[model samples]
Target chain A: MNIELRLFARYREATGVDHERICSAAETISELREVLLARGDHWLVLADERLCCARNQTLCSLDSALCDGDEVALFPPMTGG
Target chain B: MATYITNEAIAAGQRLDALAPSHAAGAVVSFTGYVRDHNLGEAVSTLYLEHYPGMTERALAALEIDAYARWPLLAVDIIHRVGELTLGDVIVFVAVASAHRQAAFEAASYLMDQLKTHIPLWKRECHTASTTPVWLIPH
Candidate 1:
């Protein structure tokens, strides 16, 4: 399946890209993150427990299942007041 | 209920006046968050805010709905500014109106607490003496 990966804050700065389209066979959000982590050191930030995930723009857990064209966002915990 | 996410400056007085007037409303409470000059023991030069557009709006709307559900509120208004902001700039403004002071105060505090943890907004602080900016983790 293909995923629309959206990165923000530290994730965007580390990756040097805001969004990207990627093809992966990962079944869940966590699995997709694991796949990304395999890329290199820069992807290691995804391993942080503080990282937040959203499936299709709605907040979801890492265990959430993904579809063919899911929009997945990875960001740090919100700091807005 | 009203929410706004913009890059423009927030006019605190105008936003307070914009709240819908109600015959039952006897009290109004408001909170304004500003960009301070220092954080984490460092002198800050500027603060950059980022957010998920669609998700941010949805989150804010849901907050207003939750506030209304928890209190007998006559009106609620929230405005959050994005982009680069300098010291002393208003970053956010929230106002709640109710029939009593206690309800208005509690609801306003609830909205701010929920917003700090639940919203999809992020802040990056640029230090005065450092070339790199740091992303602040929320408590």
Candidate 2:
């Protein structure tokens, strides 16, 4: 499955890209993270466990499901006011 | 109460007055945030604000709805400006209208706190693009 990934905050800065497309062979977030990591190990290290996942702009649990073409946002814990 | 969140333009004084009407609203409490020239050790020239459009509205509306459920709030307005802003430029303003001062004060505080912690706005602190820090806001 292919998914749209949105990045924000330091993650956006680090990757120097706000959004990207990734192809995933597995169906879960754990699988998606692995695919994302393969592209940028630094993103993997920085992303670690602090990022929140959003599916279709709605906040999702770690165990939340995903589907092809979903708009997923990966972000650091929000630091804005 | 009504809510206002914009990335375009806003009039702070007018927004405050409008939220607090003549008769029903006995008190109005307003909270305003400005782009500061300095942060910690850095001399900031201007700040740029960015946000996730759909998510921002969803979070703000959920907050306002919850505030309405909790207080006897008559009206409330939350206006936030986006793009580039300079020192003393108002970035966010929250006004609450209620029959008494208590709810007005509390709701006003609540709006800012919620916006800070929950909204999906991001800010970039620029001493110049070369020396800037971009951050995401919670509310």
Q: Point to the candidate with the largest TM-score.
A: 1
User: For model 1, how does the per-residue alpha-carbon lDDT over A9-80 read when each residue is reduced to its tens digit?
Assistant: 999889786899989999999999999999998988888898899998789999999999999999999899
| Reference A-B contact fraction recovered by candidate 1 | 0.86
Off by over 4 Å in 2: A45-48, B1-4, B128-139
What lDDT does model 1 reach?
0.91
What docking grade applies to model 1?
A: high
Clash pairs, model 1 backbone: none
Q: Evaluate all candidate structures by whole-model CA lDDT and list the values in order.
A: 0.91, 0.74
Output the TM-score of candidate 1.
0.96
> C-alpha displacement of B14 in model 2, angstroms?
0.7
Chain B vs. true chain B: TM-score for each candidate? Answer: 0.96, 0.87
- Please tell me what DockQ candidate 1 reaches: 0.87
**Candidate 2 residue-wise lDDT, B24-44, digit = tens:** 888888987888878766778
Q: What is the lDDT of residue B136 in candidate 1?
A: 95
